[model samples]
Target: MQSAFEKSISPLGLSFRIWGITQLVFSTLVTALLMQVDVLPDITVVYYVPLISAFLGLPAWLILRIALGLLASSRLNVRSRLDRLRWVIVVLGCGYGLAAGLVLVVLWQQSVTGFLTGFALLNAAFFIGCITQHSVIMAYFHVKPHPTAEARPTPAAIHQEQNRTLKKSYMEQTNKVLYKAIITALLILLLLIPSVFIQNLVQERKSRQAEVVHEVSSRWAAGQTLSGFYLYLPYVVSGTTDSGKPYRIEKQLIVLPEEANVQSVMEPEVRPRSIYKVLLYKSRNVFRGQFRIAPQGDFNLSLVKWQDARLCLNISDIKGIEEKVLVKLQDQQYEMQPGTPETGFGNSGLSLPLASVAEVINGPVSFESVLRLKGSEQLHFLPLAGNSIFTISSPWPSPSFDGSYLPGTREVSDSGFQAKWSFSKANLPFNTYLSDTKFDAGKFGFGITMVQPADQYAKTERSVKYAILVIGLTFSLFFIMEQILKKPVHPVQYVLIGLALTIFYTLLLSISEFLFFDWAYLIAATATIVLITWYVRGHFKSFRTAALLGAVITMLYGFIFVLVRLEDTALLIGSIGLFLILGLAMYGSRKVNWYGNEQQQDQPRLASTE
Candidate 1:
């Protein structure tokens, strides 16, 4: 056999570079493959954006490696120098690739617990990649020099030395794997115990919060002040003005209800709180200069404002109408507006609130009226009412909309206008509707009105889902960045970030119970962003990087604000953001080269001073 003095190349040098190139190519291919997968018909295309983001780093990273490789070849000739930089880049690229794969797998096909399990598997892959790179670097440096006494080693001896290096690398890799297995097991056990407890606590808190909200809503509706008004006009100035003298409108509205019950009527709150009240007036049809009350045509009656519901009239037909006409308290006056010749209520004459109205937080109510014009001329009130204007019960008496109130199959009843709605704790509005429902008095126009709670729980659930999706997408984008840039991100950092985002919902729910949702969101988002930004600075070594991430986090939180506020258009906005991010990444990576180290080698240039 030849002596051990002969020179030889390290097998590690060949294998390590090959392995690095393979990993880069493999990662890039996987990312492209994942992005190209067709989304199932039933699944929303937006849901795939996170998975796409997780994979986006692979191609960019590979191109970076290629650039590093070209730089190294042109400048560095020594294996030791090139290998050191190569190991760092290789390990970083592999670690990022494995991490992104794990994130995609977790998001696409697993529960929260299962996703964490996937993360542990990902960590194992990372450790394996790290050991592979480390071993090659260590083996290259570990060779013992031959003794000078042995003269010079032959080529055969050099071959034997290369075999030794290979064996040592194998041993080192095996030890690394064994250590990783032991640590992984221990970590799994430790995390599992706490994870179970934490998850249970979260579930319990959600249950308790939902229950409290229901109870609060029930009490609020029950405690609302109940009050309304009733009117009775016994005496009236039923008259017609002179021909040119702007119809001398004179009348005395004797508050009949006031005289009937002086004690109750004079009560501070009960005495017609509204400044406007209903009034009754009648005019007779008569010939010119003749004083004969004739019920020939329609009569004019209207409401006027004094301190209470009163009357105002404009008599246009005094030619065949008498100067004086009799008036009667024919119906309950919710609100009455008498029509004139100038503005005649088409066909039918005056509208009178004839039915007794009762206010209830129960089912909605429907009210009907007849604009009677003398001998029974009737116009059927169409299904023209909406919202709180009328409570049209479906299935005759049941308080529901869809259970019995189908669109085409409506049944007209004595109840005038038809309006349908559902009412319960589950039906209360959560976000924008809260302001509309809570603040609007729900009394307007010329229809009967009702109030009922909407689907509050459904509203809350939708908001929460979108919030979760936004945070999930944000995390995915960050994960992709970490992979492409080979940024160091610890598990603890991920946990803290997730916790910061998760707390946003809790904050929103708690603050919104008493304060307005807008204000609540502002306080919660600002606090969470500050906490996360501070924590991110700890994760990243540089303050500039931390501030950059802080800005991203701030923008993400603001993005969620738009999602929550613009419920109808949130999905569209989120899609546009995804497209923009993809475009940005593509543009940034256009000139990058693969098959190289992460850090470029500094080229030595001749200087005049030297």
Candidate 2:
């Protein structure tokens, strides 16, 4: 038996060196890809930053190296040296494990499940490396040594020794070839890391799309928010000074209507600007409301100059008004002026001066108005009355109801949509009376957003988010094929395959601009699958392997499409999908002799000597 110091030197030193070099190259590539996401054009989506996955590769490489070292030292039969080396491996492995755990904690702060998935993959790599290294070492130890001079007297014994040496040489050659294939496969996986930059490219393109939308919206009319027809009453409060002198102060009182109602019909049109399209609409609206003044018993009306009261309607964008607004107060019609009575009412609106206040002070006052407005994207309303009711109908198929309140009743179809909203002071934060303060009426009401059902850029961004998984799985599939077939695949071929995968996104993004998202995905995925299948068939010279790969690609693309469309259930579906994929991989590789079958085949030759 060899002493511990004698057997300490690993027979697979060259293999470990190759693995280390490959790991270094992979680390560099992963780091470069991670940096690319930071430089991508600014877009906000809660996505797993590919950088987290990239950093995990570093610890994985370290753990693998330590595991290989441990396996190498395990060949020593002597107790003392083996014990010391084992402790060294334990320390190094623990340190690396702690570092990896810290990284996972940081990732957990950003996203819980992302961290869990990453940690699981990292541990899987480490354990797989441990198993592979241990098996190779065990196989090396099992090889029988040449016969000693004391046993080599007979001619038969000499021939048997020769045969044993030949078998050992063959096993060594086989091990070298297997190790080289593994290193090559790992290198191919490393090369696929750069494909993550394609996601950044997708984001940049999406940013440009947003810029175009903004340009178009700014040229037409931005989204409009119509606040109200509030009563603006200017008054004077008299007070006695400390010096016994009389003083009067000017003030304005803003009173909301007791009840208000609005009816609007919007005609929507799609305007194309370059390759992007924006939603715009022309709205014809009718506003009717009633304002009632409390009697003397309810409150003091002595200071109110009711005659000086003016009816003001708040419009967000005066430029969007398509027709002249006319107001009818108490059966008397008055055309509204361009500016508001006081700065108390917003700047961009029209106001009508009342002729008398005696009737208004005595009882309830009624008013009506007609307005024709043109706006882009969205139409928002403010709940400025004690009880407000708004009804809207449009020929737009997609409407996103956005704001503090949702529509009480809504009906939508392929042809059109109709929505109604009801709000009261009880539900609102503020009371009916307001004065001298700037109020954000937008926060209190519902808005109708005329939206495009499929935003190609957004969908493309979503698709790009899954690039890492797609590339990783595809590479794993090819690696498994290489192992099973025992065929050598060049690193360059792997790069070409990864590039083909990366180009899928760019194709999807460009095609979706002209076609629907679903159709674009189909066309892009099919073209990519066919191209890869043909390329793989040519490389492997096997139709079965190529067909299987094509089917896998098809299934992956289909799975991702389903994930994107079903956003709410994506996590559940993705988790289950991943579990099934892992199960399939485990099952397929169950019979693989990771240690090489040459050791088992040569076992009988050694037994014959005994």
Candidate 3:
């Protein structure tokens, strides 16, 4: 009689290997197609955020195929009845696989739901086909009759048979352990594919949000900056030529403020454009400074034309000025005009005629101004003084202090925020004279930006980044439960569960816009947990098992939430969490004799048949 190993190359084994290869090839093509789905919509900038996790499906399907091939080889060696029911299930899975592949071809990128359904179906076919093949193999072995004992064998034949049986047993045991591990890994990787798409969706939404912000900012005033209080001193030089003819030349002398103080109070408001909101503000600003020209030996003071002097202040946007501005020079008041008398400054500003204060040129001159302006988003200032002290207060809760200089002191609360910036001449690169027309005032500028604390799209993107870990742990939990209960879960059911998890991100993103991120996350996570738990309860018919699954999922979501909130230390926290989870997994599966369990599960059925 032939040994089991010699009989292993049966037609059924060949067919099973062929099916495995076919499934692997088909899944590889499908995975490649799914990767192309990341092609973004037509926009000025396209971000090819690769859905690399989707590629994991290929290896997962391949692993399942390998498991099925081994199972089939083991079964082919055993003499058994052909189970028609198991054959029917395998045929059905094959049909599903073909139908899913057709669907992918028909609706490549036309519909996201179609693509997801097709992807899930292909995965399900591979998974279900493998499990069904194993079931058929087990049934064949269990129902097979042992050889009659009437014909006694020779001693040498018996010894050879015993050795063959031991080898077969060892191979079967190894295959069983490998089968369970491969299935668990496949399910985890299959779940990860949808998460990649979900992350891509989050990125798309964020890009749209940015477009909306740009549109709104274009209509309203963009960020504004104020750099000013330069003293415009016009002077005339009179001299006698070689022929004793007198000549006069006109010149403008730009003087920086010796000491400056600025105070601003802003009332901010939110304007909603469609679903997006923008920040706008009206500010009441006060400026006070002194400008003095130290007596120099370079020019004769007798020929100075101090009467042509003017006081000027530069502003970024004239449209943002809501009310009239007035400048006070000592005891005299002058109404501000639209343009600066000195055109060489290359700035748009308001000027006050200071030709009347010619007597003040001999000493330090004090000036004051009151400005009422309306702007949007951000407000900035330049340090154009030898000594400058600037203070800004707003009713907006969130403020981003940005620019070349940060606020020396700041306070933030639910009510509002206050900030102060003080700078001296030593802090600036230029001296009292700013002759470079191309000098960027923004370099020395500091500003407060009114912004939202938590953006929904951003948080959603962050959560999606943790998809692999979440899916792996969740799938492992299910696999462990299956091993303990000796109850198998269908591949289709795993796909459904994964789909539900992917939808959680979509629900969270949609709900966050209307509610706070924390509340949205709570609602989305609760809904998903309840759904999956209820489904598992129906499948297992055990409340305790379902509750345990739900608890694990809840913990994962909570852990992810903490990681997202702790942005600065997310990497450290994530590493620690992963290590702890690995320890738990290791401890949980420490005593699980995967092969022993298979033997215990199969032996009783075979014995009963005998």
Candidate 4:
């Protein structure tokens, strides 16, 4: 029942392959089990741990296959050297794991219970590997060596003793790799503290800027919304009193325009507050429309109050009204005043009183109003008439069209922008005319918000979100460099490297406040890369490796910047980028042999003293 691959491989190869597979499966299953208890944070890393483990576990699997496969071959002194290597990896691995756990608790502000839980799971997996290695060793050294044969001392017998000593086991080498990986994972978690703090700092600065904007805008003139220009009508109604006595009550009716047209020319300005800035604008608006107040049976018209009737306009901020608002009805001038809108018969938010005009029961009466309004950030208008058309032009390059409807046509460029909107009575939800204060005009308004193209805090906060990816990958990059160049990197050096990586966010945040995000990112990334590259060169002593590390780090920073700019497709693109990076890591590490040092190939000729 042996397959082609199984039949072709030697018994030694089969055993090595089986042992390699066994460790990987056991580690994966144990990881899955521990995750059930909620040991890890329930965030993006919730998915990263398992995928990273599998990707990182592959090289260790290769090391296992090679280390254990040496069992059936290799000489006496080589076996002794192997024993030394095995012990070194185990001692170093366990020492680093416990030390990292301690650091996580003390310095990183993690709870002891959390550290212990993770440490326990790691130790459990390690112990299982130890047991399995013992079995593999036992399977090989099955027979009891002759006691006299050992005393007589043959080269073969000494070799057997060496193999037994090797049985103390280099399979622990897998644990060393996994432990380093776990340690790196811990360092990444340590980085989360700074990353989160940086994010908070970004948010704090953004809030401060917002407060400044609000304060300055309040003084200058806040955002503006214009609704109505509704024709007002008051009439008397007869009603029964509680004792059946007849009473006359006065009520108001509103007449919507039959056709409405608005034209606004906006002049935008910027006001600075300390380190913050806000956008404000002054606009000239012309509202012209026809009011069709035909005969209606809703109330008795014999008691109509023509002398008291007035037109009303809603301007959200009256302070923004820099000049007098005058209406021309049927070519007659009428000045307006402010009114208490909460009662009714005016703009729903802020009411404007117009000069009294007589009721027109014959046909459509044309009216026009000129308003000089001042406001900050935004200017919006409601289409309250049967037929509404809006035409707006501004010199501000970046305008955010927002609210209930978008412009029917828009043209935007650096020079300025022009937008137009047209709507019919059928397009609106409410009737052309309604009782006083009956309609919520704000529910259907559209206009422009002066939008700044570059916002540093928002971009910095988004970059901080990917802090783990940057730290983990940078540490991983250095770890790989260490393995490839035969340079031993201490766990402390990884901490320093991770610190440098996390500091990139702070650098980006502070610098971006003054500079554009792209430029700030460049400066920060370059500074960190140069500093770390120089430090790495000091430890690695090879110009090529350090430069290569710097290049990869630069690419990592660039990739993260791209992800930050993306809103809709960040997850998909980020996932694909991670997969590609992992593939590169695997490919780069394919030929690595942890135990196959120069001494292994040098195999000195020796006579056994045993």
lDDT of 1 by residue, 12-37 (tens): 34344544444454444333333333
lDDT of each: 0.38, 0.69, 0.70, 0.70
Higher-scoring candidate on TM-score, 2 or 3: 2
Clashes of 3: 0
**Candidate 1: lDDT of 11?**
45
Model 3: lowest-lDDT 10 consecutive positions: 44-53
Candidate 3 lDDT over 267-336, as tens digits, reads 9878887777777888989999987767443343354565555677877777788878888877677788
Q: Which of the numbered candidates is closest to the native, going by highest TM-score?
A: 2
Q: Compose the digit string of candidate 2's lDDT tens values, residues 1-610.
A: 6556336645446235434443343334323433454532333321333444445445544554565556555644433333343344334434544454465456344343233333333333443444455544454344335576664358777778787777665655556555555444444334333434555676777788788877877777778888779877667778789999999887776778989999989999888878778788999989999987663222346666766777788787888888778888788777887777644335678877664534544467888988999898889888889998999999998999998888999999998999999988788787677765466565566779998998887788778777767877887788778767877677678778888888898899889988999999999999999999999999899999999989988999999999888878899999999999989988987765444554445342442543
- Per-prediction TM-score: 0.34, 0.74, 0.71, 0.72
Cα deviation of 187, candidate 1, in Å: 14
Candidate 2 — worst ten consecutive residues by lDDT sum? 39-48
TM-score of candidate 3 on Cα atoms, chains taken together: 0.71
Stretches of candidate 3 exceeding 4 Å from the true structure = 1-170, 232-253, 295-310, 339-347, 352-363, 597-610
As a whole number from 0 to 100, the lDDT of residue 415 in candidate 4 is: 93
Q: C-alpha displacement of 119 in model 4, angstroms? A: 12
